[model samples]
Target chain A: MKELQDRIRIDGQVIGTQTLKVDSFLNHQIDPAFIMRMGETLADKFTQDGVTKILTVESSGIAVAMAAGLKLGVPVVFAKKKPAVTQDSETYLADVFSFTRKEAVQISVAAKFLVKDDVILIIDDFLAHGEALNGMVSIVRQSGAKLAGAGIVIEKRFQEGGKKLRAAGIRIETLAAIEYMEPGTIRFAQN
Target chain B: MKELQDRIRIDGQVIGTQTLKVDSFLNHQIDPAFIMRMGETLADKFTQDGVTKILTVESSGIAVAMAAGLKLGVPVVFAKKKPAVTQDSETYLADVFSFTRKEAVQISVAAKFLVKDDVILIIDDFLAHGEALNGMVSIVRQSGAKLAGAGIVIEKRFQEGGKKLRAAGIRIETLAAIEYMEPGTIRFAQN
Candidate 1:
């Protein structure tokens, strides 16, 4: 976690007030070594939960999901956000609001992949508004899979997403929580 | 590769004449153990390429890319297909034609992750019409990075994609190349 914090300070770009762009290593262009380390961390955190599957959203969350999936030795299922209307074919669907795009979109996982009586661990790169997490949670609930909890690489403490989840009694663990960010300065949450 | 061939026969579904849906283990719902084996096989195949990075498109390819990235200890850069107009930054862009979707879409990668001197190995789930490979090739070329060839889990030999890449003098290695598939029967290329 200290290494991740250090990486955030050195490589992370504070974009505007809310967004921290880590495309250099986390999302778009992945640091395979760093991601593997992060995956191990997540696995260590959730190893005792009996997690059978790891769920995440497509595009950005795929790499981190993959890393954790490999370490946890669990099948990783990523919900796809298709822009066009896909003919509903036995998929667990949920509508999620993306704060970045400021739009509500549907995300889905095939019913065949997620089954009842399986423990699901949800992992993602960023947890800001928690809309994506909520969507994944909805899917897990629909599938009747037990939610092991959510593991996040970085969480924006200033955002209501993390707070809301914790308030709902959902166990949430974040490696690095950003308190605030200014033009040339950034702050971390007190451990 | 025998394990992969056995998996194809047992778990893979042949839909129509061309589409061999291995979604049960390869793409949608991954078999963690089999995937790790596939990753090891890819590592063995590309050990001599001196690959510095692993490149692939989003969604399906992310799992295999992460697998290879873990083994090679190199970063994986995934090209994102943006359904909406992405915020224009200095990103490497390429137009890819999807054979399944039958449409051309724009995919982009941040310019920072891919440098000019990097040697990249492309990883993907399926190699068919080679449109995805060609699109990735365009991105690698745009980045001025050398393509160390591709590692495909399953290549449809009936499709022109594999043939085209080999004809273009790019090194391609597929764990299981399907020569033909009938109802409930799949044939692999004799290695």
Candidate 2:
């Protein structure tokens, strides 16, 4: 977690008051081994809860979900941002509003991938408003799968998403939490 | 390779003359270890080529690209199918016609991710029409990067894409090449 926090402090960019862009190593351009360590840290927290599958949204979250999936020896199911040509119509669907993209998009996972007997751990790159995490949680609940918890690489503590999910009785673990960010200085939550 | 071939034969859905859907383990619902094996197989093929980066298109290709990046200890950069809010304007772009989706979509890589000094190895899940691979190759060429080769998980030999790329002198290694697929049977090209 220290390495991740250090990496974020050194290389992360703050676009505005809330945007903590860690794309240098976390998303856009991926450092596989370092991200894998981040995933392992998440797995260390949630692997004991009888998680059968790891879930996340497409594009960015795939890498983190993949690292956790690989480490936990579980299958990773990423909800598609849009329906594919080959995607079946019978799917558990949820609508998620993207602050960055500035629109609502439907995300889905095949019904067969999530079943009643499995326990699911949802992971993602960032949790500012928590719309993506909630969308995934909605899909997981629809499948009758147990929501083990939510894991995040970076959580913007100033946002209400993380606080809301935690208040809902869901166990959420974030590798790094950003308390505030200014032009040149960024502050993190105490361990 | 045999395991991959076996997975396709057993779980892959034949949607027509050429649409082999291996979403059960390759794309939608991913088997991490299995896909990692496929990536390792590609790393085996390109490890000696001095690849500085592993490249692919976004969505599904991220998993295979992630595996190869982890194995090769290099950064993996996936071209975005569409521009994101965080995406840079200066990019290397190419248009790709998707046979499955029945449309041409523009894909791009950030200018910083691909540079003249880098050595790139492109990898993907399927090589049916090779349009996606072609688009990626164009981006790498635009960057003036040295293209080591291309690695594919499954190549539809019946399609002309693989043939065309190979004839043009691009080094391509496919884990399993499907020669033909009927309603209930599928055959792979013998090494």
Candidate 3:
């Protein structure tokens, strides 16, 4: 966690009060060693929870979730951004608002992947509005799988997404939580 | 490779003709261990190439690319399928045709992550028409990065992608190459 917070401090770029561009190492361009460390740490936190599956939304979250899945020896299910897998009967659909895209996108997982027997751990790269986590949670609920918790690489605390999920009784873990971001300054929450 | 071939034989679902539904383990729901094995195998295949970076398309490709990055102790830069990262001065863009979506999509990578000194190893989940890989190769060429080659999880040999890329002198390593796929059977290329 200290390493993540430190790396974020040096590499995180805050833009327009809401956007944190970490593409240099975290999401777009990945530091596999660092990302896997984050994942292993997340896996360490939930090792005893009997989490049977790791879930995330595409494009970015796949790396982290898959890393966590590697550490846990479990499988990862990433919700599709394009919803192409739905042509067959192998999907569980949930609508998520893509704040960046300015549209609601339907993210889905195969229905067979998340059954009543699964204990799902939802993971992602950022937690701004909590739209993506809730979408994973929605799919888990629909599948009758147990919600284990959520792990995030970075959480923008000012956005209220992290707080709202915590208020909903969802256990959440974030490697780096940003407390404040102005035109030039960025703050990380003290653990 | 044996493990991968075995897993595919049991888990892979063949659709009408071209679509091999591997979401159960390869893409939608992923076996991190298996994928990382494929990644390690890919890493082994390219250990002599001096690959400085792992390149992939967003969504499904990020996981395997990250796995290869982990094994090689390098970084992965995924091309964005949605073109969201181009809002700044950080991207080199390329156009790709999404055969599944039946649309032309623009994929971009942050310019800072790729440079002329970089030797890129492209990785992906499937190779059917090679549209995605060609898009990535275009980005690599545009960035002036030397392409080391490509690593594919599964290659449909019946399709022209693998043959075309190999013919173009791109070094390709596929975990399993399917020779043919009919309604009731799937034959793998005999290595």
Best by TM-score: 2
Clash count, one per candidate: 0, 0, 1
Ranking by DockQ: 2, 3, 1
Flag clash pairs in model 1. none
TM-score of chain B of 1: 0.95
lDDT values for all models: 0.84, 0.89, 0.86
Please list the residue runs of candidate 2 whose C-alpha ends up more than 4 Å from where it truly belongs after superposition: none
Indicate the docking level reached by candidate 2: high
**Candidate 2 chain A, run of 10 with poorest lDDT:** A18-27
For candidate 1, what is the interface RMSD?
2.4
* Candidate 3: clashing pairs of residues: B90-B111
Worst 10 residues of 3 chain B by lDDT: B81-90
Q: In model 3, which runs have C-alpha deviations exceeding 4 angstroms?
A: none
- Which stretch of 10 consecutive residues in model 1 chain B shows the poorest summed lDDT? B82-91
Q: A57 in model 3: Cα distance from truth in Å?
A: 0.8
Candidate 1's C-alpha runs over 4 A off are A83-88, B83-88
Model 2's number of clashes is 0
Candidate 2's error at B174, in angstroms?
0.5
